[model samples]
Each structure stands twice: as structure tokens, then as C-alpha cells.
Target: MRAAAAALAAAVALTLAACGSDGPAAPAGGSGGGVTGDVTVFAAASLTESFNRLGEEFEAANPGTTVTFNFAGSSALATQITQGAPADVFAAASPATMQTVVDAGDADGAPTVFVKNQLVIAVPRGNPRGIAALGDLSKADLKVALCAEQVPCGAAASKALAAAGVKLTPVTLEQDVKAALQKVRLGEVDAALVYRTDARAAAAEVEGVEFPESAQAVNDYPIVVLKNAPNKAAAQAFLAFVQSARGRAVLGEAGFQVP
Candidate 1:
């Protein structure tokens, strides 16, 4: 009789589990659902994780809506937007990059500050080199990687370094922030200057070193709907979601400072 009762309970439990009464349905990928349409976003590389989660939420909130992203260095993404890329929105890691898009008339409205980020020294976990400050990165023996000055992170790095009046040659001038971070993660370089959010995002593989110079180059992340958006309404809604309380919480959790 006990065995029979256990089997019946198991069957009932299985039936309830299938009904989703215990928890919400798993989203196609991550989180929120609403209107159905396709919206393309050109975002900075540093925004990859947070934006991906945001995309899932946007899609869930707008049922049948597809939120696609082109995540790259802001400079590259800005160039694409200027070259007539069919993007529904633009979320740049820096205001300078966003202004480039707006100045080109590629965006529809004034850009809004969704989040802010700062630079940090990214070293492999355990910091094998025993490096701590900005000055340590300038050591002749350290193989440092930095983004090219044309990119957002690169520009910020340059400004921060200049604020300290310390100049050091990097072993490589990576084209983008992620690439520079990767150089450090792959043990190809001893150090790299990348966004604080990115460093935190890669916490398992890297340790972020906070330097005083970073305060001199805080980056403002701006987001906006595009002029040629195929689904402008959906795009605006998605942008709104990023500025919403839930969105702010998600971004903050990812190490971004909510604007």
C-alpha cells in the first residue's frame, strides 16, 4: 500500500510540474515578453552580457518580437550605423560614440544615459604578476595590452593614463575592449585596460584593479532608437525596458552603474 501511494504521488507531482504552476515558463533564452516584431540593436562590446539578458527580456515582454544584436566596439558599431546598417537601436558605451551616430542623423531621438562604466586593470585571476596599481602596469617587464585609441575603451584608457601623466607602451593595441581583455585572459599578456563592468563580468578569469586615474575617464553609456528602425515602436519599448527598474537592477548586478 505504501509503494502504491508513493507511485500515485509521483504521477501527480509530474503532472503539476508540466503545468508550470510552480514557476514561470522558461523564456526562449533569458527574460520579459510583448509585441512581435524584429528589432536590431548595435551595442558596444562591453554591453554584451547585460544587453543579451535585456534582449531576452525584451522578446519575452513583446511576444513574437525578435531582438537581435550586433555587439562590437562602439567605433565599429558606429561606423556600421553611419554606413546604413539596418539597426533598430544603438547603445554605445560612450557618449562620444553615441554623438557620432546622432551627428550622422542615424538616430531618431536624443540619446539617453542608460548606464555608466569605468576602466580598470584586468589581470589573470590570482594576479600572478603581483601587479596592483597603474604604475605597476608600466613596468618594463610587464606585457600590457590596451585598446586602440579610436575605440571607446581605448580613448578612455588614454585619457585616464594621461590624467596620471604616465605613458607606457603596450605590447599590443587591440582593436576592441574585449580583444584586449581576452589577451590578458588567454595569458598572452600580463595586463589590459578594460571596462570595470567587463572585468567584473569576467571575474572567474580575471581580477580588476581599481586605479585612481580611472576616475578621470568615466564613460557614459547612451542608448537610443534608430531612424531607420523597422519596428520603431518595439525598439523604443525595448529601450524603455533598459531604463526601467528591472533593467537597471540587471545592469547594476552586472557591474554597470545605472544612470
Candidate 2:
């Protein structure tokens, strides 16, 4: 009889042990869940500095996680993501570009506007050409670098110029805002129309000239998760982190107006 009792007790113990093991595992990083592994983000060129800072902070918060970024023109990034680029998240400089992902069904949900930026004329330090307004870009003697029409910065510049009733003949058309800004920094062009954030980030190298027409073409920045993200959990976590208070502080420091 004692043997029978001992056997039954052993069975009960084993059952209890199994039940305990079935409980959910604790998340790696507090109650935020297990946000380990890699998260690849495709973002607009203007977001380079701010996003890099955010990525480092995220990795530090989640020790086992890593954040990688691909910064370029928002339109190009949208095309790549739709074409099956392995991006976990996307941050666009304009709503139009973000809509491309939504239309292609690559976005997980409706994108949220994270920030807003306005156009500014980026010139070499000290404003050598003495550019003061959108109309100044029209002067044939003043070499100007403008972003490609397909790019967000270029589109904004176009609208700003149109609003100011000025037509500009760019000396060089760049594929991205950073490239356009680079031309000014390198003295290849007298000035370039880029985002206020970009000019502010490169304040030491370039000076941002605020024009009245810039208010007409403010760009809204949006962010979303890719539907086929390789690491959905990390993607979601990263998105949340970006919209968090700390994230806003980083972007604000870069001259991006929080939306």
C-alpha cells in the first residue's frame, strides 16, 4: 500500500512540475516583452542623425537587441520595401511616399505622423551668396543644388518656389536631400533647398536660411511597420520606442517638430 502511495505522489509531483513549466516565459526586457534580435529600419535621409541616436538608445534599453538603419530618399525606400526588401520598419519624409507602401499592402497598419519639417535653404557657412529668399535661387549666377523632383525635399522646394512665384534652374539635381546639402557644404553649389532638420543637424557646416515660402510646403513625417517584417515583435517595439518621450526629445534636438 505504501508503494502504491509513493507512486501516486511521484505522478502528482511530475504533473505539477509540467504545469509550472507551461506558464509563459518572462520577457527579456521587463514587461515590454522579449524584444531581442535585430530590427532593420528603412528611413528618409533627413532622419539619419535622429534615428541613429534613437537606435543606439533602443539597443541599450534592450541589451540583446540591435537596430540597423537604411537612410535614403523616402520614395526610393518605399519602392524597395514594396519590392520585398527585408525591412522591419519604415519612416517616410512625406505622406505620399508612405501611401505607396500602404497601397502596395506592405504596411502593417495606418502610419502615424511622428514629426513635421519645413524646407530651408542650406548654404555654405556665412551665407556667401547672400541668399535671402526663394526668389534668390532663380539668379543664374548663383549656383543651386536641388533634390530630384521625385524626392520629398525637391517636391517641397518646388512648391515653395511656386508659392513664391519663382522659377529656379538648379545647377545640379541630387537624388537625396543629404546629397543636395552636401553640394552646398562642399562649395559645389551656392545653396540647396533641404529640410530644416538637415540644416540644423549640419549647423557647423551649413547655414539654414528660413524663407517665408517655406511655411507653404511643410512635410509631415510618418512611420509604420512592414507587414512581412522578419521580426514583428522587435519592429513593433521599436516603433513604440520612436513615439516615446525620449524619442521625441532626440528628434526635437535635430529640429524636427513633433507631431
Candidate 3:
């Protein structure tokens, strides 16, 4: 009788547990949810890989949420956001670029600096040209690529070059960091000026040449939720996740400086 009663009690406990709020059922909008809805993020190209990874992690944590990123030059992204593109968040590679958004009254609040990146020369895996220093970029023979002067990476390159008193005549002015890096990968150019994080993330395809002058051109990455965000709650939640331990781990592993 005692054994039968104990078995009955165990079954009743299991039934109650299954019916509780902690059951396997999803929270809202389905069987999985913390925040649901799509979030569009306009970020700099340098944050492409890291932000994409972070987006996946955030979706897993928040569930029911979808992350869509528009990665390109910070200036371009800023222009797009101000031009009426519906974006939930904006993460720029440079503070100046971020201010463009805030000045336009498109940003929700003061942006937070999440990471910092420095410039580096991205060359082919073998670095066949044997480009050694900043001076080598102006050789006039090595097909070098540079970012468009208006972009953050280009601004940094300009500062670094000005400090060194060297002028680099590039074969192409890429629209974004990835485009510049592409010039090196496709053998279109011998080298390119890109963020160190970009080179590290693309280590499988390119090699980074560390020069001393890049120190003077470090750029900070700032993130903010837009004032007209499609999903303010989701955007804020995503921003917090990016500054969380997991996000920091991913960004640090990608070679970004923690802010």
C-alpha cells in the first residue's frame, strides 16, 4: 500500500510540473520567445563577422527574434539610416560617423563604445610584393587599394599616412573594408588598408601587416538603438547582449579591443 501511494504521488508531481509555467512550452508568439520581431542593424563592414555571430547568439538567447544586418561603410550606413531606412540599430566604426546619426536626431540615446579597432595592411597570404612599411604603399608600382576618403578606414589611413608624411596612390578606392580587402584577395592589388579585426576575421584569405603608424588611427565602434527603431525593445536587448560576456568573448576573439 505504501509503495503504491508513493508511486501515485510521483506521477501527480510529474503532471503538475508538466503543467507549470516552466514547462517546455515557448514563452510568447510561439514555443520560444523573449523578444519577437525583426531587427535591422546597420553596422560598419568591419563588424560583419563578429556582429553576425553575435546576432546568432542573441537570437538563440532571446528566441522568436530575427536579426538582419546591413554591413557596409560607416558613412554609407549613416547616410542610409538618415535617409529614412528603417533600422532598429546602428553600429558605426567611427565616433564621427555615429555622431552623424545622432546629429540627425535618428539615434535613441548616447551611443555606447563597444569595441575599438586599429588599421592594418591586408596583403595576399604570401605577401608576394614583400611590402615592408608604410612607404612601400606609395611605390607607384605595387597595386595598392585604399578605402574611399570619406569612410572611417580611409580617414584613419589618411591620418596615419599624414603622420608619416607619405602619400599612397592606390589603384582603387574601395567603397568599404570588405571591398578593399577583396582587392588583395583577387590579386587586383598587392595590399589594402583595413581594420585589424577585419584582417583577423579574414585570416583564411589574407595576411595582416602590422605597421607602427596604425597606432595613431585607432577607431572606436559605437552602437545605438535608433529613435525610430522598428523594435525598440529588441534593439535594446540586442545591444545589451553585445556588451554581455558572450558578446565580448566573440568580439575579443575576432581581435577587437574591448571598450
Q: Best-fitting candidate, measured by TM-score?
A: 3
107-225 per-residue lDDT for model 3 (tens digits): 99899999999989899888888877888888867888899989999999999999788886888898899999988888888899998988998888899999999999999889999
252 in model 3: Cα distance from truth in Å? 0.5
Q: Using Cα atoms with residue i matched to residue i, what is each candidate's TM-score against the true structure? A: 0.87, 0.87, 0.88
Measured with C-alpha atoms, the lDDT of residue 180 in candidate 1 is 97
Per-residue lDDT tens digits for candidate 2, residues 1-259, read: 3234434544554675688753333233222444667789999999999998888777656545767899999999999998989999999999999999999999999999999999999998899788888888889798999998899998998899989999978989998999999998888999999999999999999999999999999999999999999999999989988898788888988999997
Best by lDDT: 2
Instruction: Score candidate 3 by lDDT.
Output: 0.84
Cα lDDT listed for each candidate: 0.85, 0.87, 0.84
lDDT-superior candidate, 1 or 3: 1
Q: What is the lDDT of residue 77 in candidate 3?
A: 94
TM-score-superior candidate, 2 or 3: 3
What is candidate 3's CA lDDT for residue 256? 94
Candidates in order: C-alpha RMSD to true structure: 8.3, 10.7, 9.1
Error of 1 at 117 (Å): 0.4
